[model samples]
Target chain A: MEPDTQNGGGMAKLGIWLVVLLLIIGGIVVYGKRGEDTKKASVKEPIKIGFIGPLTGDLANIGANTKAAVEIGVDDINSAGGIGGRTLEVVYEDSQCTPAKSTSAANKLISVDKVAAILGDTCSSATLAIAPIVEQAKVPLISYASTAAKVSDAGDFIFRTVPSDVLQSSFAAKYAVEKLAKKKVAIIFVNNDWGLGLSKGFSEAFKAGGGEAVFSEGIDATSKDARSLLSKIKAIKADILYLLVMPGQAEIVIKQAQELSLKISIFGADPLEDMTVWNNAGKAGEGVMFTTIGTSPSDDFKAKMKAKVGSDEIIYSGPFAYDGLKILGKVIGEVGTDGTAIKDALYKVSYEGGVSSPKIEFDQNGDPKEAGYAIKIVKNGKPVVVK
Target chain B: MDIVPQLIANSIIAGSIYTILALGFNLSFSTGKFIDMGYGVMMVIGGYAVFYLSKILGLPLPVGILLGLVISGLVSYLAYTVVYKPLRARKASGAVLLIASLGVLTALQAVIAILFTSQFQTLSGLLSGNRVFEIFGGAITAVQLTTLALGIFLFVILAVILKYTMCGKAVTAISDDEEVSKIVGINTEKIIGSVFFISGVIGGLGGMLIGFDTGIEPIMGLPWLLSAVTAVIIGGIGNVYGSIAGGFLLAFAENFGIWQIPGEWKSAITFGILILFLLFRPRGLFPK
Candidate 1:
């Protein structure tokens, strides 16, 4: 074989370098043109809503759905003569539900995006992660569906569209007793502040409602063995199972319960509304039920969502997100993006057609108070309006 | 005595799953001298395979298990050949490899989410079919029994291959010193590739077993990796038998830790113990 020559400043190297530079320039021109179109449409200077969630992790489904819903909401608001005569724009950052990511996003939303009022950072820990930043920055932060009681209690600057676990669990236990008519229950909750907190509220409420949480079991969010968890449930012999799971394990408990041959009804929080769980559960999910704030705003609202966003993929929290923007837009209209004025104005803005829940009034703790819930059953593989 | 029998049974069930991960994790790690964050992603692929087959395709659970194993194993091999081989050829450092693995991890994780949509799903096999055995104060399910059986089976096969097979000797040679083994008669390239395949198989099997027990979620991999790593380290890395010991110890610490204080503190306790070991005895409980 002939001896191979090293790259002695060959023309081939120069040709390759020239192509690389051309590709970079081409990419920039394409992106810049798209940016210009958006700017011409006046989207660049629109009223901004900063949002955060785990856009690409275990919490992706819930976050993606919420993002989609908010996009629809903003589009609807903007097209309808815009909010406060200003087009609404939403900027999103992925928190991945890590505290570090949440803090960075929260700071960026305040200091960088300069959003008047912010939304989301789904996980309770994440919301708590950014709580101090939002509070100190005086940016009125509205979390759509996080329900750890600590969220509303974090401070006055933090307001949530979803009811706290305090209300959700009491309402859940009430449904179990009054609706499902089951006395003994198995509480299988993900082991976290969120799970433990919901379990506590449900336990207290269930006992108060003349029922007992026979066996309350905890599994780490990363647990792999539902057999042990199910065996313990079988051991308890609960008449009904209350699973407080993240989107990760919600379907697991449902199917594993089928394996254990325990035919008890499974009730969970709104996180169970995830399409993955619904699709995974399939026929097994026929009798399953969970609590949400309320049903879709109206048939027309849903039809609009179906046309604008993908309907079958809609989760419970999206409607609430739309309501969040509408509510914030009103606040901005009244107070003109001043955090103090917006924060004070939020308590006074009363709007009908609030998504997911009933009424929009902040309780002493900044959680929505006295909201009716939506409890639907999966009939024929679809969530039928079962009152 | 009631708790003891149950604890022993529970420990074995948990240990079996962690063993699959630890054994596979240590094997490639010892020889290649690089960690594969993508191993967890391989487990997710295995899990999704089983779920799609058994649930959607309506295939039998056994077929699903085979499919999951084959799919995940092939994916792992292809990933190494495509993404890792070039990096290793260029003599990339360990940190660069870690970052590359993370990239693979992120991309694989995204693909799984896009396909399954981040829902918790399970394998539908009668292997767990509501069969209950009341053993003492605690009752163990059929699936738990099967998991124990699977663990023992893998351990036995691992022993046979490692102690009595030629490829096993080659693996040992490489683990001892990859550079020295390459200079010797052993084909280091072939051995390294085979090690990755076997490790991938272990990961796939782990997903199947865990899928039967709990449920399979994309995010499920991190916790499994953490447990397996803890077991490997505590039992002595690269020591397969020692990992089984480490698995039990870790499970026991997690479960019974709740007994002393509020049960929610189990994780705090588990991590606290992990930190203690790290600070005082990072060599692990059964250091090789």
Candidate 2:
């Protein structure tokens, strides 16, 4: 009976493998036919570029806003005579704002999609995760939202529309000490490259500006509970609590801190620009301020995003995404869809009247050449820039 | 020094949530005799059900919660009948059952994400404000207090039922020896079905409380699953009362262990204790 059962199991395994082999062969035939179809339609076969962002998970809202902006950018370019007679298209992949997922997405885009250039990976961690992959693949990887200082050194092929945290942290430190009269700060950041970079930069800048970092610690990015961590921060009695967290979790931190009645002013980084933080946090988010890279998305762009997304609320990164796509479209149009040529063209390209910035250009290290900082405060369920 | 009281309060609050999770997990595992990874998605089902009914459809919160429990229970029972039971009838190995459950977990989680769009949502909007209470210099919200009370109440009720009820006796008999239980004319499948339902109800309650306390996301259940499983192992696998003890102990150790260390060390501390127990006392503190 045992030998009979073993033979039956072997047959089943063989049958499964046969089915798998057939499926693989069928897939290759379909995929090969599709490639030929694209070649046949070569006259206007659309310049396909890849996009990686947090389309799902904790940061999905921010991704949604940015994605809407990118969609608008694509629409705008297509309407303007199809980017030198070839319509531009975007192939988007969800990274879930995780490094591991971002790496896999990058590999898929590079190997399978074979995109001319790649855009996005909104989170700094995700951008960094795909940096080596893109560098090795020689893909011109342009990010709209990632701002960690480490990203500047990721690779020659890596570029971002957003300014590094190095500039923002120093700007925030100067503002806190000089404008707000805040001396001692307690830092609680999500334990990721973005958070660590901001905390380290802020602490160093604050110390240089004649202020003290009273307490600092890192927590898991996905932590739901912050009471104990808050308790520890509360014990320090710092004047300001500088929290670096993602959007969805930031609301919880604000609400929990309010519940704990921590008697310190709260400050945050760019992620607080998300409307979800303001809406979900409600009263708790009132008066909370955050530093973000300055952007002035055109009024027309704002109207388009509102009409598209059913809301006028724009994530701070939205304009950068819009600008990033526009830049990519221009460079790809001029450089003829070669990744190396696009990367070289990007370094010399200059744009005026972009939604993100008045003039956009990339420096030697692929950092944004023109970076301005704005401090925005949440009041009455909206973020208003503080002049 | 002043932070100690709050830390203790925080520990208790965390412990209570873990206890609730461990209880549901332990009850189901004792009867099924296989690690049901899909058990976690039952909480997501409940949480999303409540979110849809209460938040979107504007149903009364109580009605939504009750229906959430019903839906969660039905899903859990269906999983057993549709998936596990047929496989059990085929005499599938425990590992195969575990892998099947993992498939259920992934598929259900993906469905929830597609339905709800994977945003972190809060149920506390039903209340005008989550009232905060001070206990030993630590602040806990009304939702957390409710969770703590529910944890204790469920523990007592479960203890009573398991100790005295006929269905409980049948479950015990089956867990002890399924073949012997069948020979004794006990309907093991029906009893196990009910066991899964009860666990599902407990999991739904936990999901609601956690939703009110923190928030709900599709992936939220995975973390709670890990925490609860750790609690069950540390307390004593298959031991009902030990889940409570292990939950509190694990929470306390995690909360206090990071007093002088960074909060990022919490997971490490949790697993460190888990490893210590596995190495020294694989049967757990209160061996069943």
Candidate 3:
């Protein structure tokens, strides 16, 4: 048999079928045209705001929380008739907490989502990566937590709602020197931009405060054993411990230090404020002190959050998220959908109160310029204001 | 002096972990003649499995461990069967297999993230209870001591089997020459399968120990994998005893390296040694 003959009798029937297919496609096109005209009359066009953060990875919690915060802001605005009378919508892009990915996410949010603004990013590295993306797109991006000093100064288009590392680092070191009343301190930080940035600032502030940093060491961010780290800190006979690991490694160092009976005052940066400390270290974490960007959780914030979320999962994380959204909304209303205008609005704006903290404002770099770190100590299973 | 014992003890402990992972990594690479990057993902999957069973589902720790082991072992076996087996049949290059392993790594990490979320989770409450023990000069938790014992136990069991058992001899023969082992009337497929299962077991155990010590997270696989690989490469690839010695050496060196310098330089020291070795003695301390 010929090779073409093997195609079967069905192949010859295709000429008539092609004509029928075109007719069917033409009918559908007519229906779509009619439907498009009708829908334009009824609903208010939604203003799409893009959100970029790590929804997956080691830093998913902060990423997820920051993303949610942006959404909450949009939700509040849309519920109240939105900006320029258009409903607000958020398009989320996952950054994986890397600058490269964050930049890609920024581009997609701008080109694909066609969003007027963006909210993101818990990591400073990601902030650095996307700074150019947002600037080129001229889309105002208000970050919930990226606090690296370079992030805010990236361009006029970027702004940060969270407090800067500068304040937190200084506050953390100061807590060790003054509050813990320790004259000699040893620092153990993770090796990274976040760790390095904080280390430089903390050392300067700590030395100025008249405390000697006998040792300032960094371990791999993912180090399996920090006992060697603890040993180095212990050898210095440091009266205070300055640690800057993420929640997981922090617990290891804390628990190991406790086991060794190396009872020194523990001072930490903001990431240490995660619940993992109490969850993993338990009683061993008692008396630890740390400084953070957010306003302390007040009773009023708790009550309001409970009323808003009613979900046990988001209770702790929701307010900061909600605050992030509201800030974005307020900026949008004042800035008139312009990225630069919104960035400018973040500079002078003040939040009356929000879930994670009270009264939010940013300096020129989009960082909470005047934002001071609030020092808190663990006592009786709760973080009490120490200063 | 205060830091010396601490650093030594810490390095030994850290080395034990690296050895656990490195031993398994080499086991697969040696026999298969290709380094499977998926070895690290197995650890994350195992940890996430235990976390789900024990913490989320509220099962007993031992049961969770068993569940984790079974799930992880089965997954690795399937990975070999489905992905590696097909690729090998196609006469795929090692680079191709490496790419497949990266894909598996991504998909597995995504699954873990979906199931457990991206947050670092620790097994606490009944999963982790109070048990602290002290030694002269420095101290470690009962959990840490238990991990050390398990590491030693697994090493002995593996060494004994590899040396004495017929299947073990087949594995060695395969590592030496796959074609020769198959021509000698040994079922290479069966032998490779068994090796994969053993490697998976070691990986699962490594994951469990890490859960007991440092917390577990989906993103932890690579860096942990890197450390183990560092030990394996430094000690001499496929040399079990060398891997063991390499692990301890690295741990000890890392601990001792940070003595006069700040603690943060600890990673830099480990990475620097890895680089120096790669440059100067790439064949490692005990090259095969």
lDDT of 3 by residue, B231-288 (tens): 8889988788867887888888877876666666766777888998899989789987
Model 1: per-residue Cα lDDT over B1-288, one tens digit each: 234555456666677777778888888777777878878888888888888888788888789889889898888887788887789889999999878887887798788888887655656443444465666645566777877777778777876787789998888888888788988889887778878877888888888777776667777776777777777777776776767777778877765554334344555765777778788888787776
Off by over 4 Å in 1: A1-44, A175-186, A209-217, A226-241, A257-266, A282-289, A312-314, A353-359, A363-365, A374-387, B1-9, B49-71, B78-103, B114-117, B125-147, B252-288
> What range of 10 consecutive residues in model 3 chain A has the weakest lDDT sum?
A309-318
Q: Between candidates 2 and 3, which one is better according to DockQ? A: 2
- Top-TM-score candidate index: 2
Question: How close is chain A of candidate 3 to the true chain A, as a TM-score?
Answer: 0.79
RMSD of each: 6.7, 2.9, 5.4
Better by lDDT, candidate 2 or 1: 2
Per-residue lDDT of candidate 1, residues A298-343 (tens digit): 7666776677556655676677677777889878876787898898
- lDDT, model 2, position A112: 87
Q: What is the interface RMSD of each candidate, in Å?
A: 4.6, 1.3, 2.2
Q: Give each model a TM-score.
A: 0.81, 0.95, 0.87
Tens digits of per-residue lDDT, candidate 2, A1-387, equal 999999999999999999999999999999999989978987777888898999999889888898999999999999998777999889999999899999999999889888888887998988998999999889998899999999999999999988999999889888898899999999988989999999999999999989999888888877788888888888888999999998878999899898888888999998888787787888888899999888888889989999989987788788988888899999888878878999999999997889988998999999889898889998898888898
Best-fitting candidate, scored by DockQ: 2
lDDT of 2 at B180: 93
Residue A48 lDDT (model 1): 79
Residue B156 lDDT in candidate 3: 83
- Tell me the interface RMSD of model 1, in angstroms: 4.6
